[model samples]
Target chain A: MSIEMTKAEVPGVPLLEVRDLHVEFHTRDGAAKAVNGVSYTVDAGETLAVLGESGSGKSVTAQTIMGILDTPPGKVTGGQVLFRGEDLLTMSEQERRRVRGDKIAMIFQDALSALNPVLSVGYQLGELFRVHRGMSRREARAKAVELMDRVRIPAAKERVNDYPHQFSGGMRQRIMIAMALALEPDVIIADEPTTALDVTVQAQVMDLLAELQRDFHMGLILITHDLGVVADVADKIAVMYAGRIVENAPVHELYKRPAHPYTRGLLDSIPRLDHKGKELYAIKGLPPSLTAIPSGCAFNPRCTQARDVCRSEIPPLLDVTEPDGTPIGGRTSACHFWKETIHG
Target chain B: MGRYVVRRLLQMIPVFIGATFIVFMMMYALPGDPVRALWGERAPDEAQMAALKADLGLDDPILLQYWHYLTGLLQGDFGTQISSRREVIDVIGDALPATIRLTVLAFTITVVVGIGLGLIAGLRAGGKTDGLILFVTLLLISVPVFVIGYLYQTYLGVKWDLIKPTVQDSEDWGQLLLPALVLASLSLAYVARLTRTSIVENRRADYMRTAKAKGLSARRAVTVHLLRNSLIPVVTFLGVDLGNLATGAIVTEGIFNIHGIGNTVFHALNSREGSTVVGIVTFIILVYLVVTLIVDLLYAVLDPRIRYA
Candidate 1:
């Protein structure tokens, strides 16, 4: 069977676009609105960092995009995941599967758990080529070694036969990256890829990922809770709280002037050498439960700038403007007082 | 690997000795004496009784008798059957092949049907098909094996004549089918349930999700990724049940009148022929030992993390 390649690249079209995505979990406790009206776009050669703490629906949106959500617990009630002009959510399962790992791939946080323990790393990597490309075992093995080498694995040829457990944590993460890169997909969604590694190894892995993304010019969606990890690599950042993107802006602009109080708290929480002796700043409250999100702006309960307007009415993701009222392109915040917050 | 095998073999020696010792002691402690059972309704005179005891070396001390038994066993002499007056090994050798044939066929059916049903059930978990399979397996597990065997014999053999009620000889393999099916039913249910549970658990594992993310079809993911890991536990259970399966042949054999080792042992137990019973029991123990060793070796094959030190 012939594999379907991604649709021909159109210069103006975004490589990947998610529009008005809504995901819910029909759990025994209640229906949880895990993702509500989330939207984003990634160009061919840019990294989009989805920043959020655990349970903020960042991974949920990513899973929905990949068509991997467990349906009984997770349902994509409304969404469109468009990859190269074709909406993946509307494709047949067979068609979607063809798109998965071929057009879009995902790398999980725990490399040790993600890789099949019983299989040799080479065999696991080679499976993509064999299944999708119909390559012979010998060809797959050669390609596996090449992919391993491409990911900067030391002694790739000798280690090809080693199982996942035989490799160190960082090496295993590299192997995961290598597997995702094997088919040369157009987009790669890495969900907390470095969360399980040591500090130094995390940097190495992130660096490798960033360098590879540049090499392939693939759209990279980096889903991470650690704000520090994405500052160097992300072109744009979307900060999620209570399953909603409260702030969206260019990475440098977000760091310089966070238009939402939640983003400002996240930026302040990061420890620095200059602020050594004091307690690190922490956001005041836990995220609202998805099952019972606050009525208006979900972040209102925790926002220092919360007003009666913030509590009574939901804030839309309005475009952020300068003090002189010139709109910043592609910058939006779901906060009523974003103008003040950005200028504060 | 060779060293591991040799080490496992060496370990089996003590187990074999201990098992044989237990069987021997249990027979000695049994209420009915083999001599009395042999002379049933015929009282032997004092002199005749004494002569018989001396002839069989029953007059020797217990330790000396055990020594003789051990020495004879070491030389591959399983002593003689008290009733038939034939060598115990010769009797077992004659019956062992029939038992092996019946057990192998039954166990093979058990594995194939069990795993197939389990795979279907696991893949369609929470669906109607999975519910039906689970309910049927549970019902099978709840019912006694003999009840199942007799039911099949009545309906399939006696009523429908799908299989011969009894075998004419060891070569009459066709007669073994219905009995084999009966024998396999309980184990099949057990294996199916175990496999379903294992596959369900493995299906939720991160690696399986990774397999799907790597663009594998769901069918391929379950077969290639989930099934192998799930079989590890099922294989272990099967290995441990090997002796139980062998002895299960006894009941099935008796019901069907198949002259297997199990049938011979059944008669020996009823007749209080300790030597024949001990010999067969020891042979079953050996089979169990060998099966366990094979299972341990299979672990290394199934999971790469397990290696022979």
Candidate 2:
């Protein structure tokens, strides 16, 4: 009856670790490199926020991890998704499916579309228990009500029979979260979970998610474009541009001193109430097309600090340093002049 | 829901009357006179003809005649058949069972074959199996119903001796199989194509991905998530198609010499039996209306979003 799995018992093993992940989309035009050598790690009870603008491949990385990418158009060329010391990429499809909801669950952005329109919320939630745990219908229904109540949905008993359309958008999203948490997986990957909600509702959902993650000591991967959304919750942040992570740092360190020009530009673009009358600073130029990304640094054309070296050679994610030349632990930047940007 | 059903029932009143009025007007405007047809080859005397006309209320104004006919309908009197002098209701009642049997059999076959083929085609979309199913359905759709009927009768019935060649007066399931299959061919094609398209569209839906993400196996996800949603449009199509099949049974019934309502209507139309024709037309309209109402209720049942209130 207990849906909980054994925790990440080994202290040294990371809950989830992605190494050198490469994904490309094949089209008539050419292959669009969506995720290029992306890697990150999430420890138990850690909140890792992946931040990027539209078409930056953050969502694609999440999809690849979930093994939900549409093939024929999108393909994962190379990657190692290690969950608790086991490689998921090489696992059999059946084995991976068992791991999907039981080990790592996902919450999608558009709750209205993600929930089946024809099915009741309770039935949809109950399906997880019925399919995986082989629970009886009555037991599953009871668990569904319990999950609804856990997500703080009002009138859970009465609204259990209501269809997806019957509930409000926020309620529907809570239902999505409840479904993900039903099996109490070790990791929960939420792809832009609060992007479709109103500002107030967004905070509530995020708060609830953070609370749940902490209470369960689960690894939470929050994928979003808005830096402000993850500022309070994320312990670490990875900023991506075009298909690569341009900067990675602790949340406070990144906020205090962005090591990449794109990260700096994004932080500056956030509108402030103090400067209401002043014009808000916007990033210059658009993101490069994935199929024809610039040779050197993809952001060089739009970057203010473009130089000869930056235009001629692609930069690997190198260890970022302070003005005193002291290396910042767990901090790396793909920019050639990371020191200057950090100092400035 | 009860109120909704009552309102829908009340709304059918005007539709029923309008349908019956159209059939009555068309029969009235026909070239031949029913009185002359009643007299056959022998010419009736002027007084005899006038008396017959007065007795039948044919001498009254068209509007008055229609009103009289409507009142007779309300009183459960469909009038008498001109040829046999039998009550129209009794004639229709005798033929009703045969038509129902054939229609139901054909409809059941259509649903089973159409949905089965559609599911297979959708699961293997863009593959050879899908193409083959599509090709067969296209062939069925392109051919006319009468041609299919005759072809099946000749090939499967007479030539191959697969089943009985003609439908018998007794209730023999074997006798009805060939005709039922022939009648179902075109509709089967339509329903199959619709199902395939709907399934293909639903396969790309976000909920289907959600189903897969919930640890559902590929096959289970397609059946439980994709099939249920895809079937909404197919159910709607079936409701209308069932009514059409009932009316279309006439041609097939005639081809196979089956004594159904369609055959009765055909004979009445050719012989200028006004009362019988009108009675049958009205009955078909009522059946069509009832079938559509049931379909609408089913929509509410299948899709909780569609509340009648």
Candidate 3:
């Protein structure tokens, strides 16, 4: 199948688009910026993987998009998240709730802990059908079994009556995926979806997601720090650092030539089978605290290309040029040495 | 699940034995003879008192008396109440239903009102609702149960004529309401506070966020995801308090003129009816054991992670 780039290729409008989103948490100490002017869009049937390390605001951005952030402590201070041309940030709680499970669903990490312990798997899975679709108990239960089967849960018919504790972690996650797909929502936000599972199971779950995405033709936002998983599932990649997206490019382009220094470091840090038994390069230093972000580029403190100018002036996401000086579609880094990094 | 219940039942043996032993020892340690107390100001002569004590096996050695009491307990015979010359079980049995009714009503009211207020308060913590609930619970808790009972009697029963004059006299909902409210007030504060803390803490659990992420409504997130998990601790507190209510609502019983186990115990003490006192204490211990077991079972059911072992 021929894959096309950019929002124009998609038949309908973007399923979800978040622009200049800034999420802050007010604490006794001060306001902590969790998500800083982050922007991305997922068109119909597109998979945009938000690739970032922990504490890099990947999950918070997803939460803001889903409208599930806790008020008081957590507040979305700025930006608009447009879902089907409606501003989700400004929607009333009731309207947002109506859209949540029915329009755009989210699959959380650790599905074993997410499902209710007391409730039967069938009951929990069937809840969406019963609540949002207004199906009867019998009908909902049948739909639940169908969902379980769709997610490849073994003995779906028999196991539907079991409780959450009875299912293994991988199975629980499959059930979570099943639940998320119940309404066939326009977008699915899988936040660190397979992080808690074993590698074998992680591959299986991600493959399941990809398979489901093709069948449903739904937009998928896969949020994770695992580049291998992202490479396998994502069509587009948004590399984040210190609560900001430093690089946004198609997956193949990003893998072939990572323009952002942080993205390059992340790509190099992974231990690949091609470099078997060699010492893996790890990105040095922890991610900067959002409460007190560095001046210049957020990654400049750790960036090897850092010059005096890189230390004082913050870098914006700029255009990356080809070897022939042609501009790529997506924004790259504003680091003065971006040409050297991309071409070298 | 069935095996779990069997194991729980077997575990109660040691508990009941320990309870019975303590009850027997404490009854003997108390000053003044039951036979003498029964005789009142006109003290029974030494020989008559001695005969009565022997007949009841109190004249036996402590070990012998304990063995007799244990045997009697096993045989479902608690001997006879000295003053009434009635079977101890019969006396407790007569009073048992009334006490149970009072306790059940009181407990239901306490949970309904307390949990309702607590949920509202906890969800709106740091808001006016939280402040109001805290104020009311603290206020009710500070005033002793008897004072609240008497106050209800004064205003609700005697003055404004909202309720009937006494618990015994009134058969209407209005009558039941005052007694239930009076008896429930003390426990209400504790339940409300427990519920508030539990719900607030439960809100912090990662699963709640997970539920929300599932795109579940806020109501479902709070009620199903948070409230059920939070209720385990509240169940424990309620279980213990229900035991106390069953055995220790003496003052409320007296103020309301209710003929229940609390009142029975009071009469037993005054009349120095040793058999009746022993019976009441033993029954109270049994009630506590049963309530504890029930709550534990409920906790296990509510939280699948909890196992008997």
lDDT (10s digit) by residue, model 2, range B120-195: 8987889999999999999999999899998888888899988677887626767888888888999999999999
Better of 2 and 3 by TM-score: 2
RMSD of each: 1.7, 2.1, 3.8
Query: Which of the numbered candidates is closest to the native, going by highest TM-score?
Result: 1
Ten consecutive residues with minimal summed lDDT in candidate 3 chain A? A1-10
What local lDDT does model 2 show for residue B108?
94
Candidate 3 error regions (>4 Å): A1-12, A273-279, B150-173, B307-309
Q: How accurate is candidate 2 locally (lDDT)?
A: 0.91
Candidate 3: count the clashes.
0
- What fraction of correct interface contacts does each candidate retain? 0.75, 0.67, 0.54
Expressed as tens digits, the lDDT of each residue in B79-105 for candidate 1 is 998767899999999998888888888
Which of the two candidates, 2 or 3, achieves a greater lDDT against the reference?
2
Q: In model 2, what are the clashing residue pairs, if there are any?
A: none
Question: How would you encode candidate 2's per-residue C-alpha lDDT over A1-344 as one tens digit per residue?
Answer: 11124342657878899989999999887999999999999988999999999999999999888888888689999979988877888888888888887779999999999999999999999999998999998999999999999999999999999999998889999999999999998899999999999999999999999999999899999999988889999999999998899999999999999999999999999999998999999998999988999989999999999998888899999999878888898899999998889997
CAPRI verdict on model 3?
A: medium
**Candidate 2, which segments miss by more than 4 Å at Cα?**
A1-8, B42-47
TM-score for each of the candidates: 0.97, 0.97, 0.92
